[model samples]
Target chain A: MFDLPDAAALPRLRPASSRPSLGLIGHGAFGAFIHPHLARFFDVVVHDPADSASASLASVAARQIVVLAVPLAQMRGVAVAIAPHLRPGALVVDVCSLKVAPLAILAEALPEHVEILGTHPLFGPQSGKAGIAGLRIALCPLRGRRARLAAQLLRRGFGLEVVQSTAEEHDRQMAYVQGLTHIVSRIVLAMDVPPLELRTTTFEHLTRMVDTVRHDSEALFRTIARDNPYAAEVRERFAAATAEVMERLGAP
Target chain B: MFDLPDAAALPRLRPASSRPSLGLIGHGAFGAFIHPHLARFFDVVVHDPADSASASLASVAARQIVVLAVPLAQMRGVAVAIAPHLRPGALVVDVCSLKVAPLAILAEALPEHVEILGTHPLFGPQSGKAGIAGLRIALCPLRGRRARLAAQLLRRGFGLEVVQSTAEEHDRQMAYVQGLTHIVSRIVLAMDVPPLELRTTTFEHLTRMVDTVRHDSEALFRTIARDNPYAAEVRERFAAATAEVMERLGAP
Candidate 1:
């Protein structure tokens, strides 16, 4: 299911020389990850302003397939900056946790001729530290050649399990998947430390999540809570459920 | 720290004839586990009322070491029933997750001459399905003998790490460790299921915790919430933290 366009359908894709070079904008952790794997399939043009002060934005936008790997908050600025220089018929992909916001930013900022595809490489620096083989990546095809280019590159190139999803469905599920998880971890870390001896195996397993989001930048944690539309509802439900459990047990 | 009594301390314990016969009461899942290991060190007599309604409580109490593996709520009645029959100088061990309550019940219900030892063998059937070499079992020595028998049986007999602690400290630490874990899991399971495709490595780790608490008996869960002194406080703090995070995100 992940490999939607199979080997038989490969013939329909444009030939090698006609295909676009991968334009990887933003050189953060995710950008660094997608670049090398992207290079394996096509020539990669990287534009990380942080590393090169005078980096030419037009050069990166000129590529046929561009990946937006900037922080979630920076999507708008980056999309607007590179919109004018994006080549016609190019596919601009986003690698953001929450799809709806980034997809909207990319769709409105880029020219009508440019296509959009959204993806969330669920693994990060630590999890993807080894390699991304067998890892999960959500693919939301927005405006484009049915996301054929993005699907082909992610599955065939990186050996990732591409779960085809909608921008709405991706954000809805991530509200609980990423939103609830990060909320619990961030809060638990904020609490006083429990005695080490009382940490059971299940507790150890639960805290692996604490380790997952523990060192994340405050910006990323806030983005999961604020950016996802369904996050508010999920948080309210989680808080309500916890309150009910405690109330049933009576006060402390 | 786990191996409190090294090999040198073994000599301080009584010999085979001087050591007490193991009398295991309430052959529940945990009781069955403790029986076999007790048999390895001493003769064991099991009296499970569920299996044999006419089970002679006197026979079990007559032994020198009687392990009360009854449900948390049943501890008081079980102790009262066997108190009169308990052999002189015998040690009654209560294996309950929340130590403060059970320890109090056992100490109050038993004869003053009857020694009390409280222990929580932190692993369950599923967790200990494999070898339990590195598992932890908290030993809260109460009334008499400093719980040397239980310490030796758990550490040397079962290859477990015995954490020597008082009932108060064990219950205190467990409030955050177990109370928060069970509270989050119970609340999560109560909520609507998120899309399965969105289960990441961390989410999968989290759901493992849910699985750990899912099949647990309602009586057990209620005890975790109601019996432990710190459980209510931890649950309140967790609920408040969740609410604060939602408010900070400006979400409902």
Candidate 2:
């Protein structure tokens, strides 16, 4: 019974300046998705070395909250490159799926004057039609007063169910949530059923899962399955259960 | 583009009174599910040594279609016992998940006078609010004229997408559809995340699959995994794909 406050009841959070600015690091699907929503709230700037940030995004880079939404592997390098450009006391946040490692990277790379916060939006960009209406966003605070202020702003401004969890706890839970889900989906895809013959409700559900992760970049899958410390343990338990079932069924 | 004719267009079918009265060999969850739907069309009789047939199901025992909706391991025995009581020319059908092995058992045990057909409803009985509106139902015609008539009656009356496939083909595809889905759902359950921490869209999808299968009896799981010939091959492919991903990710 959590009563989410009405949007009107929340404090009118105008970005500290005449026109608040926001910078996003990863311009991939998730970044592109949140960009439109953030643009409504602040002047948004995005940096993705892999792809050119859109013209609209590039136009707003001068004065904004710089967000590093890159892959965990490239987060440090991206943060280092963008740190010099950010205005003093500009709020910096990384939207990496994994937290602890990236949070540490952002803390060490950015200037002490710039505030840093690590966030992982639990839903994916492809969750089309099911917008971020009832979703959880995990926020792990790393740096100064501005970082806390940014988290509060997200809660007060957008009706986001913000849960404060340590970077370690976040990754541990993510191992089971993200790591096992992808693994299970990959296994289902490997079954190689000719699409014509697939007709069960269960098969359709499994195919949905496979379709969700299969198109995702290899780097993203690897980072989720290997880089996150809790992933290995979760994977082991999944493998054990699979083996046990196979043994019981005497399957090859 | 497949055009499935509406139920009203099909010829009005009447159960052949000359045939032996219908008999239901098992009164389990699946049996109870289709029982009401079937009762609407034909006079029905049930004989479940394990569980007493409900009063309503027992009331229509005089002469009707004989259905065996039992666990795979007990199916053959039930078929043998019910064979003696079936009225002459009674059309026998099974709602078992696996088809090939059970088809063979029914063919061997039932009296030649009694026609047998193996039927597998693609949707679960407990598919609560989402009723079997657009679901596919596989019908493997095993014997006589009565069996064909029974299959046609189901297609015409229920508006079910009735696909005619051999018992072998049905079992082969089921390996990927049922076996793989169950294996993936069980793996998600084995991950052992605290309920609060598991909030991802992918996780929610996985939990729905687990919830669908967890209420299923072990005998049901075993039947799909063990009795179905195609299950081992599907399981092997799933295992291989999982191993390939793990190896690619350099996971020990």
Candidate 3:
């Protein structure tokens, strides 16, 4: 039951209650950025694990929708804390960058009755600062009515293009997307700022790009590069391609 | 002599009469785009070798100023064809992407009496279509009064910022500027275009960048990579850093 319809449908299927009570669990940059938007259609309540322990998380499970907005490293702990309280028919979701890693934690930690969804909001606070009306969010349906709700909320309510994919396929796509950009950026920033005289628009634009992600936490960089199963192969391809280009230039 | 004059000297230097009759040696995209601008300030003649042969080369040497507008690969032959015809007083200039390589060819191939100036206009016809009033042009004075004249035309007339540097310094700087960008762009373009649903704004911008340089001739790519002496070292650094990042990502 997805919103994938035909000719007049042109795209997807399904229709459910558009607005559901959402229990958001995290208040980091991304979490806070999307809070106001989610609050529009959702009877929303946010829980920050750092502020107070199980008490805050307890408030989330009773709601119709529970979203885990914590970091990748903290997924298992978050899943465990909320699993007990999520009763039957309630949907749980996550908005992490990598899909497979966090979704797996949710499946292993949560009970069978708790329906689940995995999402990766492609833009962050900086990119979304202008408003994320036309942004992209990858949606992977795990179980129950919540997947349809995610598609509706992400597509209709917020105007995001909800790209439907499985957790494995999402991770595979991200290996080149999230994985390659970060790797290329990191490698470029590791060098000193090139002198002013030599700078061109292309180089200047690239430097500005590096500045945008300069504050990305080391933990996040390490996790993305290491966690996604497909990253290693993409990295090898990058290396081989780089070598070939250089060899074509006659580099020994 | 650089063009760093005080407040009263700001308006200009050397009267318009000091500008001599100009001869443009190629009429490709850049040459055509700039021909009208060059004509605005001086008596101008354009000779594209592809269109005409010895006669066009003959027309260039008699002019007070001769500019090589040919590609990097064609610089030596261009210089040779014009060498015997250039008068002792003429100033010769080249606007190749890699300044050192073509300037060296110009220096060796042309007669000693023909003064040389190495330059790189940092924008292309596409970028400059909106009028090139505020762009940058690197100026490396190799001989005579030609460099100052170039700085004047680019600055006071066309509003280009002329960064004074040596050919070696220019090449060293461009090793990262032109070298890294083309390499990064080429590598990114080598990957298949990701599906539309999965596209983010950043990815969209990167794809557009690939489009910008997509039509770059293979000879242009190879000449820039191989001819610039400092490019090999930069390529090596990029490779080493890429490997280190992939290793940190846990690649075998």
The model with the greatest DockQ is 1
lDDT of 2 by residue, B1-252 (tens): 111223454454545552234555567788777767665554556665665544333332224466777788887676776666666666667888988888888889888876677888887765533666567899888887554555565666776778889888888888778888787776566556565563677777776677777777878887787667877787778778888877877853
lDDT of 1 by residue, B147-250 (tens): 78567767776688989888889988888778877877888877766556676777877888887777777677777766788776876777677666667677
TM-score of each: 0.85, 0.86, 0.82
Give the clash count for each candidate.
0, 13, 7
Which number leads on TM-score?
2
Candidate 3 Cα deviation (angstroms), residue A216: 2.1
lDDT of candidates 1 onward, in order: 0.78, 0.70, 0.75
Which of candidates 1 and 2 is the stronger one according to lDDT? 1
Off by over 4 Å in 2: A1-18, A51-62, A146-159, A196-198, B1-22, B52-62, B128-130, B146-156
lDDT of 3 by residue, B13-89 (tens): 44655545788988887788788887666667778867854346787777878878788988888888889989887
Off by over 4 Å in 1: A1-20, A33-43, A52-54, A146-149, B1-21, B32-44
lDDT of 2 by residue, A7-105 (tens): 454455555454465667678877877887676566566666666535433333334466766778777676676667666666777788899889888
**Model 1: lDDT of residue B34:** 65
